[model samples]
Target: MHDPSLIKVGSCYYGFSTGFEGGPGNGSITIRKTCDTTITTGWTYVGTIWNSVPAWITTRLGSTPPNIWAPDINYFNGQYYLYYGASIWGTNTATMGLATATNIEGPWTDQGEVTNVNYPIDPNVVWGPNNIPYITWGSWTGNGINMHVLDAATGKLSTTDNNLWHIGNGLENSTITSNNGYYYLLGSRGNCCSGVNSTYYTVVGRSTSITGPYLDENGVDLNSGGGTTILTGAGPEVAGGGADIFDDGSVKRLAYHYYDANNAGSETLNVRTLFFGNSARTGAADWINVSAPIYTPITGGTVTVSSSIENFGWLKSTVNDGQESSVSGAMGWSSSNSLTTNHTEWVQLDMGTNKSFSQVKLFPRTDGANKGYGFPIDFTIQLSTDGTNWTTVTTKTATPLPSGAQVYNFSATTARYVKINGTNLRTNPNDQNAYRMQFAEIETSGMNSGNLAVLKPVTASSSYEGSDWFTHRVNDGQKNAVYGSKGWSSNSSLTTNHTESIAIDTGAVQSISKVDLYPRNDSATQLGYGFPIDFTIKVSSDNVNWTTVVTRSAYALPGNSVQSFSFTSQSARYVKITGTNLRSNPNDNNAYRMQLAEIEIY
Candidate 1:
């Protein structure tokens, strides 16, 4: 929910049914504050009628459905459409249903059953190209898991209901997302919300199509029970499987719930924040609870340091040299006295030649005095290659603050990024004050060893609204776009008719290596085309002269998918994407809306 008057007006949410009876009394769908942890004292219930009565429940039916499992909510048509599952425990006779309401607090109307399969449960709905509706669900029976197209006008299944993929043996609760051409599925592998004994966790699979043959990170089939465990139970809090996967524009995350044995039936929410886990944010299988949500402080100017602390109730030792938001990329560090509170002051670190850093140091800030080791405080310093899956480094109490200038010798830590975390607050133990974090000069590490940085256009191709396709340059191989300081003058007239090309001023680049293209189908007046878009990749050292690098026929299918072409080339000044053709039009048209990802010149 958004508005021009408010940054974010409100949001709607749904969760597992509470199994209450009489009316929708036992079931629940909630909408509350996005950043607020406190649940509203009162809730607007949507009633407890199941989408379909299981054979077992029908046999024992007193009047209503037995239990409601997964509840998914999506906004459409000025109202909220909720897709959920209903079934009797231990029976595969599960069914899916839809309900609509004008507001989160509503008089929800049941739209009838969309599926009558014996194993159709845990339904998740998504909109594909042209606003076409689609639903993905996991089951314990039949094909195991599948995806189906839903009618846009009526929330009913279309003829496109194919068993898209399958998950073998002991798996349920699957979700999917299409980004940069890859459709990722995050599925639960064990039991979830089962008090103290559910052994549930999460696994992930990816494919280029809505329906698959989905494969794990290792390229194993998900239908054959193959997947890379994205998350699992590591502590007493995580017991079973309950997963909800989503992307927040920049990064993808898996949100799930687990039961804590120590707390007795206390199910807590956990999120696995990621950025292409294997390629960048690796080893993210470690489960982190949502009990204490922490967000890093951001600033417009320079600061010595900015940090956030996640409370786990007990003290933890630092594992790695900490990471800070200011240490890396465009939002880099700088110092300013525009602080309104003494408890928290803005600190900045110089990005230097690059827009970010590799690491830094943090200490206690007692009236701007460094308390590196004066206090016996437990600290947790973490680092992320992509600022998501943070890995702890070390947890040692410093000897003390050096007598001279509140500085400590952390040696040459070789960190392009750094973060400082602390405990032992005088006011509230649960909440750590951002101001107490003492800091000093950061040892900015050298640049990355990768190829020269590539610039990716932020705006989409279809929305080529003048400012689209602009180049935001970077000194290192970092992915961020800063304004004014370091950017190339973007070419706005790059959009072509069948054979379009954009030439970069190679005076800035030392060499050229790779190119990535993003294409969004534009079916404005008609139904648009389907997969298999043929095109050629050409390069030129000079705008007038060009050479074909790689020529191959390709396709841009019906759903969300991205295709890329890479080849080695001489230091070229111009890069062009000459499309000979695209998917055949379903409604009849030659119009193509293509999106570009990045072009790398090393």
Candidate 2:
């Protein structure tokens, strides 16, 4: 939720998009200043750069099971260019293709192929220190990744084809990043898209020089088995796989995909935040997911807010300044070299001095040009302490045109810095709510009364695997798994018939709440059971003898479904599920994957 008075910023919104079905991999395009942490504004979706069948990407490649994989973006020759792959499903034949637009949202022109590697998958382009163009990409057909120099302007492969390194028998989805004199190459191994049965995870390797040998933590050759695993799957429904390496100025984060037992990679997106340690290269870093990104409101000082816009792929969308109709002239927004005609541009206010102001206002020079869409403006606002660190306050919206100055307020209590972001412009004539640009003056003042709080879990527990697996069910979806996906299928539970129960480490306890129970469900055609299955739910403060929370007998469970039940308990540390009986479905390995989603202790 965005506070109208405050500008909300941060790439966390990518999670919202990630969770969306058919969401692309470029994640979020950001025009961030170095120090902005709460990341209040200035980000947008350029286009679905990675997904092969992204609705809009249909012009070149026809929609089929396996088409486009991942897309990598970089700016060159005064234009924003997108390089993507067109690989044949379950086969190599991967070709790197190019598209360029004067703006992020584009009327992109397919520039042709960049690589002809047998399995030329996962293509990444970089401009070296001397301004020479270089390309790096990996293959799924073999253990090696190949690198070569390219025409700085044309992207044609140079004469040299140096084997950067090789790792594992086959590596999928490889990423390359450069920082502080070191080049980092990251990749994920094992099967991806297995739904609940996926064995996907991530690993990383780095090199000091742009060329040659990259090594993992123990100094193993990534060309062979040299990279170290940075992340592994945990809890129920194996997680991990498909990792992208990105830096938001302040920290480097590995944004990847995972299937929570509840949605199984259906509705929500999950990411692992990686922090760079003293070593500086990209390897040897601890990663974890703590809910989502954090935002701290600005308080007592006035500071200028500015940004460097990079089209995060989703371009050629609707972007309007303020004009009521498409006939009305609206100024096109652009990066120093944006490709789309009505491309989205980033704007910032030089607050002059560092003073905390509650509200900031932008006066439009005209009713301006409005995209045909009803409410044309879709942008975010952010605040910064020093011109560097910024935090997003909230997202703001506006009609085609406002009389004088349009006021988009935010509730964020940020101090001493302010910046507004303009993004998500719809360019194609058929698109809607496109954004344009116009500016007058910005006003700032006072703070609001709310202090920030943490998002606490409403339910809690841990599961352990044991002989003769157990199945526990949580049926009441309301109080047990608060603020979750719709339909009963959104609940998380753990069902195992183990003599030993799973142990959940509470770290620390807050207050109290209820527990829910439900039978686990899987989509494998191999398992057959109807609606309603019998199961028992148990709770334990310590992983010892447990007390039954709830139980049912000979109940039929909905096919591939989730249900919940609730109970009162103190700040307990562990929870268990034991399978007393099985429905008509045959007992198969992992017939019951744990459904535990969240634990709440108030």
Off by over 4 Å in 2: 1-66, 159-169, 235-238, 267-274, 278-602
Off by over 4 Å in 1: 1-24, 28-63, 141-143, 160-169, 247-252, 277-602
What local lDDT score does residue 22 receive in model 1, on the 0 to 100 scale? 35
Q: Compared with the true structure, what per-residue lDDT tens digits does model 1 show for residues 1-602?
A: 00000011244233333343332444333332232211111123433433333343344333346345577766677776777776656555666777787755456777767776647777777666667888877665545677778876777788654544443345677776665667667667765545677766767677766667677755678877787675656556565355665543333445566675655667655444443311322312211212111111111222234442323211111211232212222222222222233333223332321222222333332223222322224455544333335445545454344332222222212222344444432221223322234332233322232332232222112223333223332111222222222222222222333433444443222235555443323333322232226666666655678778768675535342334455653556556655455443334344343333333433
Predicted candidate 1, C-alpha RMSD: 18.0
Minimum summed lDDT over a 10-residue window in model 2 is located at 1-10
lDDT tens digits by residue: candidate 2, 1-602: 00000111242332112112333433211121211232333233345433334433333334432335555555668776666665445654456667676754445666777766645656666566677777766655644566678777676676554444343335666666666566677776776656767776666777776664777777787777676666565534255555565555444555555666654444123333343322222213321222232221222222222222224321112122222122223322223333345445555544443433445555543322432322226677777756688778767655454555555555434344566666654332332422344343344543321111112112223333222121111211222222321112211224543222223333233122343332333335422342224556665556566778667676654433334454553445445454444433344443433333222221
Q: All models: lDDT?
A: 0.44, 0.45
